[model samples]
Target chain A: MIAVMSGSFLQRGEPAIMDKFHRTKAALSSGVDIVLELPYIYAVQNSDLFAQGAVQTLHEIGVSSLCFGSESGDISRFTSSYNVLQQEQPAYQTVLQKNLNLGLSFPEASRHAYQQIGLATSEMDLTKPNNILGFSYVKAILDHNLSIKPLTITRIKSAYHDQAITGSIASATSIRKDLLSKGHISETAVDALPDVTIQQLHTYKKQAGIWHSWEDYFQLIHYRVMTMTKEELAAIHGVDEGLENRIKKTARSATSFYEWINKIKTKRYTWTRLQRIFAHILTSTAKADLQPFINAKTVPYVRLLGMTKTGQSYLNDRKKDMDVPLISTLAGTKNPLLSIEEKASHAYYSIIPGEKKQTLHHQELKPPIII
Target chain B: MIAVMSGSFLQRGEPAIMDKFHRTKAALSSGVDIVLELPYIYAVQNSDLFAQGAVQTLHEIGVSSLCFGSESGDISRFTSSYNVLQQEQPAYQTVLQKNLNLGLSFPEASRHAYQQIGLATSEMDLTKPNNILGFSYVKAILDHNLSIKPLTITRIKSAYHDQAITGSIASATSIRKDLLSKGHISETAVDALPDVTIQQLHTYKKQAGIWHSWEDYFQLIHYRVMTMTKEELAAIHGVDEGLENRIKKTARSATSFYEWINKIKTKRYTWTRLQRIFAHILTSTAKADLQPFINAKTVPYVRLLGMTKTGQSYLNDRKKDMDVPLISTLAGTKNPLLSIEEKASHAYYSIIPGEKKQTLHHQELKPPIII
Candidate 1:
């Protein structure tokens, strides 16, 4: 199976505990044929947009079945709920607006909207993180009219965001939380991850090389938020509609990233949404930089991270039919979006522990991994 | 006497050992009538521009005599040398061009130019730090034709930038170096400073509030230097003549400010000049913001950092004759220049140790000292 993964940063808008190379190695040893990077922007984005980017990329690469772990293990329920939301679009939007006006979070408002449109079900819980992403992927497939089929595998063990392990397959969220708190992988967490991944985590911990959280970037973010005018902050991609004023005001006294999040979190904006916005702010990502890609339905390139020999042969055979450039090396690349990803990667390296920091990680310096 | 001092960041282009409030208190207890701030732009600038700003502000505020510490302690020699360089401009220019062509630094070339034009004297040592500033102050007096007499006091005990303690009077540089290296003020260094200054230093050290150097800001600087293109860096003041290209190239490999300095230093730019340039870059000071004041040959305002009772009366008596606004408080101050100072102060607090950090030092929160 091909794996599309976040590189240096992850969906929680923090640096990955392990660097991309180690993560790719983990995937390779775990029997994945290929590993492609989900660009930083998409990787740190909210569930809906992130799903769209991943689904679109996978479809373009001629992947027929898109399978993901979901709590319900029922793909038909997700598709059915997505179809109902699509059929009653105006009614669903009206209810969503009502919920939002009452200061419910986006996910909360979305769930309320689904219920109002008679689309909520026991097997299709949109509030669950995996289910939310699963629904988004199926919706993107239908919206784009692609020929890709959707599938689901049952997620066993701890819930998506739970920090406590419940079974043999602990959630990735729990594993990361444990690793950060204890600074090493526990035996329980080791059981949840592949041996290759466990080994990498252990090595990074020994060297104090594991990245903790967005806390490492809190100082720069505080400086930016404290210094920028409301108008200047309003120019960032996710900042909008008086949110800049709130953030600017709260930033003066908030000493840490967690404090800023707590101070600025309103019922309308969820914790995850604020984290994503801060990721953009930390990188200084402007709205203009993301506009072209947002307007386009297809990703500009399939950036190869790592692949096995079988995967390489398959790519070579399908190279002639590829719709977009398959970028293996960054030399002479003309795409502006990819250039932003390169800049984001450099930003990622800037926060790693000093001894382990490879401060200059230009795209040209990294060759595609082959195993 | 009125003391025009640098604020949070100093002429050496790093955070002050203590905040402005305590520094003002130290100045007041040591017999200074008033302590006014040299706004951030001029405060962190090179000697020539810094002297110009201080002299112009003092002249506008009806100060009659400009007295400063100099190695030579001879005002007439400074005046005579400045006059000869001004009167024989073309001859000095030719010699200056020749020295520059021979790959000498600007200050060195200017000194050589003065000597070539028969302006050198044993009592007019322009190569010394205080002497250079002393000469600039006198030249500014002549250039503006202000009604102000120039006087000099001999700098005793320790030479500027000398880290070794030669006598009871330690240089400010030596005190700062010792404090950073040991994390406390030594009794020998204490003997060199006023009791009030010693108290402040001890308090800051007790709380771990001592700022080391540009090293504290090197990470943010590295991020900016790495991510910014040469064109983007070119917009900063003092970045010119393809220096951006060299800096951009050197930044890719240099992990620290000192490392970058070693790689990028050339014959034309001395280490101090480069430190000042990096100070400007760190604050994002653009050429456009400095052009108006440079072209006008006057500072925008005189900000009152602290004052004693006699100093207050002196300011009151000269209020009608003041050419620029003397700002006692920043609330409702419309000057763009003061805003920059405020931002620079916030940047200073960002690097201080967290527990001792006063992150929200607003203008309204800090009233002028009454001693």
Candidate 2:
């Protein structure tokens, strides 16, 4: 079966452990047929927009069903909540706005709004990270009226935010924590990851010499925030409600990335929300840069990152009917979204050393992987 | 006599060995009376502007004589060259423009223009750093018709660009290099500095925990250039003639600040010119921000960094007759130049640790130092 995943080259303002090339190779080796890059504009955002971009891209590529891992693995629960929330849109929005104005974060505000609208039931706990994202996926499909069906798989062994590698199946957060703490894949983390994934991780570490993390980017973020004027910071996407002042002030004394975030975090702005804002600042992604794509019917292009033999056959058969062009190389493309992607790629690799940086950066101009 | 040093708070895009407060205190202790800060807008600029700012500020402060160290050690040489250059302005401009168009750096082009105009006499070799600055100082006095008399002292023991500490009388460059290499005041460098200056350096290092250098700022500069769009960079002061593109490109793979500058440098862009451009980028000093002050008859305000008891008496007697306001505290000040200075101060202290950064930054708002 074809596997679709967000090519999170940069996630929440931090570079991923494995860049797109290595990640795409891992996916292809792990029984994934086709791998399409979820545009950066979506991948680095909050859950709802991220879900919308993934679902729309998958729908355009003629996927029959989308399966996601969730704490509440019942597909009916998500569908039922989506139906109720859709029917009570005005009431839900009003409660959402009221809670937001009362200084609740977006996730908390939306959860409160859902409960007020009688959409939060015992069968579906929206507070869990996976369940929240699962709800978003279902909501995106139903709201957009896409024909693709939604499915769910029960998340096993560890919770989404769990920081320990407990068993053979562990959360990505836990695995990354384990890897970063020891500067390599620990024995516990290795047990949780696939063999192919382990190989890819080793290769990336050997090539890049270090795993990418928020610490690698703290100085850059501090520099950007420190140098940017308040008006300039306000122009970046997700910098609202006079948050730029707090960011600038906190950045003045913050010695680490986590310390800065803890200082800036409030009930009105969750850690995740602040991370999204920082991501926008790091990439210089202004509101104007994202305005056109924010409400687009579908992403302008579907970037093909890699494919297996079977995946190649699937694309070969369906190429003529695909609604959007499949971008394999960035050489002559002129899309604004792609331009932002190119910039994001540069920023992602900017921390790498000289020869390795150029080699990895040149990957953006190369053709997609075919195995 | 009043001391009107260029402050060198940031010299050639690098922070000074001692911050302005310590430096001013050192000056006051070393027989200097009044200490006026050359405005940051001009202090961090090219030699011509730096000289103009200092000459005009000293003239405004009613200083009767300006003594500068020079390689030639002859005041008439500077005056004669200035006169000849002034009379041959049109021919010099033509040759300067032609050399600049042929990809010569500003200093090289101007030097060539001087030679073509017969102003590069054997009496004053314009190629010498001290001589160049001396010429600019004389030019500024003549160009503005300031009444302050210009004098020169022979530079002793070390040249302007000397990197090794050799004798008691050494260049500031050599002393700084020696101090930075050993992470403290070495005996060689100690010999070159006064007891008060050495004490101040020790205290600054103890309080700030580090000596500031271009290496300390390389990461921030690299980050700024990497994330900024070409247009945004082009808007910064000194980023001209498509240098933004080269800066952005070079920053992609540059491992260090010096390496990046080296790669971006050519016959057309000298190292010092590049440093000034980088200083502008670091401070976010836009051309528009400096446009009003560039050609003004005198600085809008003379900031007093520090003074001695005698200096206080002198200021008290002359305060009422001064043409420009003397700013001892930044509180309630609304000048654009002051705002830029405030931003620059923040950028300067941004690398220090938490409590120290706040303490050092607060110095910007405090009353001038008195010794």
Candidate 3:
């Protein structure tokens, strides 16, 4: 199943929310063999974007068998909305905007359009945003002519927005919220979480690293857009000609990243579409420069973050065939910026209270913890 | 005469000797009004190389004259050496190497080559390296069919290698030795120096802004070479195609920068030549890349380190048809790098130290003292 997941948005042009390499490693370690990197723009923008990037990467990768969790577990009802998005496609643009113009929030407008179309609203709980994202992923996979089959995982209580850690497996959202609020691995998350997840969180907190979120890159994003020449801005990953000048001029008046996006976003663009443009603009991410990288996915070297002897051997056996070199220690090298990202991740990981690393401002006391 | 002078050589693959922008400013501020930035590779290496860059830049810029200082005040002597270099140069190739193989120093080897040519022993005085450089510049201007003429300023008392400052304006060698000895500008230099010069040097020192020479970037240079693929290394600044693998093999064995150059030097290639190759590799300098710049002579950047109001007004009048932009202030702009460079130059100017600047480091410090 090509399970579409929202990759963490890296705003502020810092490192990703979790270590990107670390996150990829996490998914790889979890037996989820192929984790697609969701462009940060799609992750930060509203639901429409979640669909666009998730669907596009999936389409490009030729992924099939799309899967997601749904509040409405029943098979027939969910299909009705899915079918409406696929087959009986009324003008989604007109319907969605008409609802929004009537003072509905974007999510409400989407739901209202679904209900008015005689889609089986009774059987589908289109209220939660995550489910809507799940729905969009399904509809987009179908629309793109990809041969992906959709699968559903039924919900087991603890609402999508729930911050409480009730069971052994806590929601990622709650875990992240709790981790940030407590400023280290929370005892609740550490205690309730499965063993593998705990080690990942603990290693990242207190000593080795910090996390960056899209919410923080507001200034950097705004400034980058404002400064770039229109021609240069047009080269941004998602930006097109003429739109760049609009973005550049609008960027100056933007109060924040979101404000800039709002000013630049247009009828042809969804917020997610616009967010991707902003992300690219902020990072100077020219598609011409980076497209080759998209096709050429493997990094030249695999840096060892943390590994058991078994993991080490697993890597050693595979290293011979691997196209890239693997780097473990930086005892002799001259790269200065390399270690800083890991150190920051460790700082963020430490925020969950009562973990081995409970310290704040992690950079001050970073000494690599040797296994 | 419009004498063309090449600044420090930036040998590719090697660590940078001096920052080009800073050196250019220092030269210009020290009455070098029409500064030429001979690509770093050419400037750092020995005489033949110094000529290649300086001559090329002069030819391209359409400059008519070249001024180089010589201990042997007779300019014709340098011209004769120039003529000798362009001839079927045999004694220079072998005799020079024979001296080097005998463990003789740079001066001894240089003298050996000249003496073999039946030149007067005193005429071949190799202690004055600048004279050799001047000789090469003249040779190259003629060889390249460039319009530029060559001129010489007689050496003023202080010999190029003299450990002691024998005059008001000591040779850069003595100045550096004195700085190293005391870790600050010397009292002798302070009293003898022009006021404007002292002001900038003090600014640099106070700012804790390191005046990083070739030494500081040694690690960066090493890491850059080590990290690159064979093809990438070959494509680097100075590396020729086959030279890529040779460098890669050497990189695996060489421990230090000098060691690498020594390992690579051959009968055909001198240490200075190797140094330039290294510089090219590190800085991503290539003959093709540099050739265009050399042909362009100088970019139309006035790049004022510090200018009087009269200079500004004169520029204002001159700028109407000026091809380049007249940048006065960075103005919270993206071009802060250029401003940072200007501020950095404040450290190299050596007179009226306190008046020049109290510091020239972090953004917290004051900007360069605008004249």
What i-RMS does each candidate reach, in Å?
Answer: 2.3, 2.9, 15.4
The candidates' DockQ values read 0.44, 0.42, 0.03
lDDT of 1 at B115: 76
Ranked by DockQ from best down, the candidates are 1, 2, 3
Candidate 2 residues A1-371, lDDT tens each? 66655553444545687788898899999888889988888988878888888998898788999999998999999988877877899998999999989988888898898788876667788878889888989988988889988999999878988888889988888888889889977788878999999999999888888788877877677767776788999999999989998998787568788999999999988787788788788888899999898878898988889898888898888888988898889888888788778777777776676578777777878888998
Ranking according to lDDT, highest score first: 2, 1, 3
Docking class of 2: acceptable
What lDDT would each prediction earn against the true structure?
0.78, 0.83, 0.51
**lDDT (10s digit) by residue, model 2, range B1-371:** 77765543554656676688888889899899888888778888778888888888888778888999999999988888877877899999999999989999888898898888876677778878889888889889888788889999999888998988879988888888888889978777778889999999888988998878877877567667766778889999999999998998777567778788999999988887788888888888898999998888888988888888888898888889889899998878888788788777767776676577777767877888888
Task: For candidate 1, write residues A16-116 as lDDT tens digits.
Answer: 77677777878888899888888877788878778878987897678989998888898889888877887899998999999888888888998888877
Clashing pairs in 2: none
Better candidate by TM-score, 2 or 3: 2
* Candidate 1 structure quality by residue, lDDT tens digits, B4-73: 9888778867777777777787899999998888888887777778888898889877888989998888
Output the better candidate (2/3) by lDDT: 2
**What is residue A346's positional error in candidate 3, in angstroms?**
18
Model 2, residue A274: distance off in Å is: 0.8
Cα distance off (Å), candidate 1, residue A82: 4.1
Q: Among all windows of ten consecutive residues in candidate 3 chain A, which has the lowest summed lDDT? A: A361-370
